[model samples]
Target: MALLIPASFGNLAVSRRAHVSLTVSASANPRTFHRESVDWVKETASFFDQDKRPIMLFDGVCNLCNGGVKFVRDHDRNRRIRFEALQSEAGKRLLMRSGRAPDDISSVVLVEKDRSYTKSEAVLKIMEYIDLPFPQLAFFMQFVPLFARDSVYDNIANNRYAIFGWSESCEI
Candidate 1:
C-alpha cells in the first residue's frame, strides 16, 4: 500500500514498507521542495552525521553524472564535497533514510547538515561551494525562476542516458 502525503516540495508516495518516493508535477517547481520532513532529517542524521562535510550523490553509471562529479572535484580546491554513486551502499542507505527511492537516480542530490537538495537546487548549492566563476554564475542563475530552471534540468535528465550513455558499472 501507498500513502499520499502532501509536502512543501511535492506530494510524497509513502510505501507500506516506509519507503518514500518524491513525485514532482510539471506545474510544481522542484526547488520548492527544499525542506525535508523533520522525521526524515532526524532519521538520516546518524547515517550522515550532522557536522561532517557535505555529500554529493550522483548516478554512477551515467557518463554525464560522472563527468559532473569530476568537474566538481577539480573545481573544489578546498574539497568541500565528497561524492558517492547512487548505486553504492552508502548512497542507497542515505536515499532510503531520507525518504527518496533508491532507484530514482535521475537527479544529483546534495546532502548537507540537516537537509538535502535535489535537481537545480542541488546544482546551485554545489556551485556556492566551488571556486571562482561558478558561484557568480550560480548567483546569476538564481533569478531564473525555479520552475523554469528545473524544466531545463528535467529535459536533460530525461535524455542523459541517450546523450551521454551509461556504463555497465559506475566508473567512480
Candidate 2:
C-alpha cells in the first residue's frame, strides 16, 4: 500500500515544458500521448506550474468520480484545490509527470508540489486541504494502516461504475 502506485507506462519520455494555464481544463477527444506534442499542446491548451495548487485528476466519465469532485469543490473552503479530468490533456500530462499511467483512471490522483498520491492516500491527503471537520477526520484516519485503507478504496473504485453509472462526456 504505497502512496503512489507504479505507473503502468514504464520509462515514459519526460516532457520539459508542459504547463497548465487554467484552473480547470477538459477536452472531448482523448489523444494518444506523444512526447513531441507536449510543447505544442502547452501553447494551445491549459498547462501550468504544479506548484501553484494541488491538482486532482479523476475519472471524467465516472459518475462517482464527478460526484466526488463536486463534493471536494463544495467543501474546499480555501479553494486551493484545482481539478483536471483524467481524460483531459492536462490531466494526462500531469499523470505522466507524476510517473503514472496516463490512461489509468481507476484511482483519483492528487499532485501536490513534487509528490503524488493515489487511491486511499490521495483521498485522505485531499481531505487535509478541505474544511475543519474533514481535516480533523483525515488526521484521525491517518492512524489506520495504508493496506487496510487502500483495500476499502479499491473495493469502492472497482464497483463505482455499476453503482453510480457513467457519462459519455465529462461535465465538471
Candidate 3:
C-alpha cells in the first residue's frame, strides 16, 4: 500500500513481502550496488509499548542501519524505543503523520509526539535514550550547527551505498 499526499509531496509505501529485490547503482557512484526497496510488513505489526517512547524508523536491510538498531536495542534498558521499518504499514503511517518524506533517508529517524528528527539530530535524540557513553555524544553533537550537521549527513546519505554496500532491493 502506498500512502501519498500528492498535494503535500508526502509519500509512504508499504511493500508486501515478495522477497524480490532490485539492484541499482549508487547515484553517487556507478560501481556500488544499491537496493533499498523491499517487502517489510510482517504477518503482525503492532504499536504496543510505543505510546510515549520514540519511534525508530530505519532501513531494514542496510547492515549499518540494522547494526545501529541492535546497538540501541542492547542499550535501551528502559525500552524507550519502538522499532519499525519505514517500509512497514505502521511506519509509513507514522512518517506521513510526522510530515517526513518516505524515501529520503539513509539513517534512522526519531519520532516524538510533536516533532520528527533526521540525520544527526535524529541520531542525537536516539542517543539521549541510550546509556551513558552514547548519551555523551549527544552533548557534543550540539556544538555543531544544524546546517553543518545536515550537510554532512547528506553527503553520507548520498554515499552510503558506495561506502556501506547494499543488498538487492534494500528494504526497511
Candidate closest to the true structure, highest TM-score: 1
Per-candidate TM equals 0.73, 0.73, 0.67
> Candidate 3 — what's its lDDT?
0.62
Q: For residue 84, give model 3's deviation from the true position in Å.
A: 0.8
The better-scoring model by lDDT among 2 and 3 is 2
130 Cα displacement, candidate 2 (Å): 0.6
lDDT of 3 by residue, 15-131 (tens): 423242222211223222132322211111234334767789877656567677888999988898888876655555565545564444456678765567878899889999888
**Candidates ranked, most accurate by TM-score first:** 1, 2, 3
The segments of candidate 1 whose C-alpha lies over 4 angstroms from its true place after superposition are 1-40, 47-51
Looking at model 3, the pairs that clash are 22-169, 35-170, 36-170, 60-172
lDDT of 1 at 129: 91
Estimate every model's Cα lDDT from 0 to 1.
0.74, 0.71, 0.62
Question: What does candidate 2's lDDT look like per residue over 1-172, in tens digits?
Answer: 1233322233334321222222222222223332212322232223444346889999888889999999999998779899998767677667766666566677899987557799999999999999889989999999999999999999999998889988777779
lDDT, model 2, position 16: 18
